[model samples]
Target: MSWFGFGFNAFGQISGRDRDGNDGDTSIVYTPTEIKCHVDEKSEKSSELRASWSRRASLHLNGGRSLCLAGSNSPSGICDTGCTDAVVGESFVILVFPDRFESWDLDSDEKIPIWSMDVKTLCDGAGSPFNLPLIPGGYIAMTPPFYRPLSPHLKATRLALGAKHSVLLSASGAVYTWGLGSHGQLGHGSLSSEGQPKVVEALWGMRMIFVATGGWHTACISDGGDLYVWGWNESGQLGLPSRAVRKAPKYQTSEETVVTDLPTCGAQPEGEKDTQVFISIQSFPALVDITPSSELKTVGCGSRHTAAVTRAGDLYTWGWGQYGQLGYETSRSDEPYLVEFFRERQLRVVDVTCGAWNTFVSVVKKEVATS
Candidate 1:
């Protein structure tokens, strides 16, 4: 398994070291650069890249003996020999084991755990992970000392968090979103904040197998391999035309810029054929066609970009690419751009994970191994 990274690297998060083992030499990686995943043994059962604001971890599930590949200032307790999984945040890290869980504060040289939980208490109070609450029609979230009971209990199958919003996927393939909707990241057809989890009416019948959210947008892959995107299109992260990418961009210099009033409501403005509808914020889910023939297997979204791997063993990227996060050796795009580098090298992308300002992709030789 090989790893490649690109985009912001001011802190050596993408690459642990420069040519001279110095972090000051490279501030931004403008292309796909291979990064080492330090491992004691190659017996991992599965792996994932967990990213926070400034740092990232390459976590390996080695038959319950978890290992973390991290950079400077990572919590020491995260590498516990018996760890099963971990959740990395901006200021803390939570290590989960079979018997218990431990939370550690970042940059704490003392190496003391700030929070911990016994597996029995958790499974008994919350549910399986922590089943103490016993909320009849709801679920509980382990937020350290308190149990944040999420309402409705929609049989959620997966959850994706964004900068200020959250997206939940139900077992029935329905998508729900809440939180900051000023930029229309909720896919609710309106720029209104939802106090509770509200189902995205636009995708009512579609059976989505996957959902993702980051920065100011949300994306999901339908069962038919179609991609639907919504939320802020400021950087063309939705793979749609945006006024922000125009030569003479309109709007303001602050983050309060709300994008609305365009001709993208399933129709065109009565004008010329070449007329472009530059959208800033898409409050509803819009189907994005990327190579009408190929089917997308999975997708990943960064703060200002998006990436996806097709079943044909190919990678496609779009949106903000100022730091080469798009992996196509370009700065940005309003449409999906295929990354030919992997094809030329005969590599097949299997999985992808996007950080706040960077992207990491895992791949293997396109040809099957006969040895």
Candidate 2:
């Protein structure tokens, strides 16, 4: 069977492989550098097990300068090593065994694990469970919470996957969700799995559009521009008073709570309404999207802060700039403050993507007026 090797270099190149032999097509530039590779032992032998070459290997440079790899042992046994310039407290290690998935915090050297069910258990005497043969060359993106799809069509607009997890969208001033929906993120009141696209039942009759997911918690927007959140509300991520998590997921179809409930007083102007929002409620403090207009858009989560982009194309960030992931100049605050301020304020932003801690935006240039 063939093996898979995946990783990102400093120049932002991605590479990977699965059981099938390698073709050079899996290379991409400026993609997230983190990588994962899988191999199926059922495949034949004679596959060359070797490290894939990278065009821009220099980008893999880390302050800690350590190199390590881990996975099932067929080509070789478990591989781990240490190198120079590697950040002592920032790197992570992953180990995949035949039956278990383990992740490590190399900085602290702690092992975190997730269990993988045995093939028999997963199959229940069936031939086999649904499994996708690992494609060795897939790239990885460094996303917050988890790696989520970011469609350029939904730039500045928020989108998320639900529990019965489906692709959810807030576009053209309406909420649309399509995918698994044993949970009510689809907005259909009944607890049923929707194989095809359909408007949410509770939201079916309303002019509401826009949706966000924090694991199970979901939030949506209405045609009147009001916000509605339901599903798992643990840790107040739903911005509602209810602390109980919903088991039989359904769209909580009322104006139950608004986005304003998320931020404390003075986060926004009085009587200023939110036009669009995204919620990421994975852990700690949940993320809240605050888009006042094309010019004023902000995102914040957790205990220490918030982030916003001014209409002028300037990026402003506050709250939890500790890791410099906020793209700020320094990390000295426990409260909200501006970290990165762009000098060119007239640029128009076509899109913004925010992870758990870092945010990315695509902008377009504007012609200057010649006086």
- Could you tell me every candidate's TM-score relative to the true structure? 0.83, 0.32
lDDT for 140 in candidate 2 is 15
- In terms of lDDT, model 2 sits at 0.33
lDDT of 2 by residue, 35-66 (tens): 32222223232111112112111112122221
Q: In every candidate, how many clashes are there? A: 11, 31
Model 2 residue 307 CA deviation (Å) reads: 7.2
All models, RMSD in angstroms: 5.5, 16.9
Our tally of clashes for model 1 stands at 11
Q: Which residue ranges in model 1 land beyond 4 Å of their true spot?
A: 16-25, 39-46, 75-77, 120-147, 248-264, 269-275, 368-371
lDDT of 1 by residue, 1-371 (tens): 77777778776778634434455437677667776655554455236666655677766654545656465576545576655556666676766665765777776766667776554433332212522122223332324442244665587777777887878888899999998988889988888888788999889998998888879999999999999999888888999887666643344445333334442346554443334457877889999999979888889898989998898878999899887778766677879989887888999998888987788888888876686
Which stretch of 10 consecutive residues in model 1 shows the poorest summed lDDT? 126-135
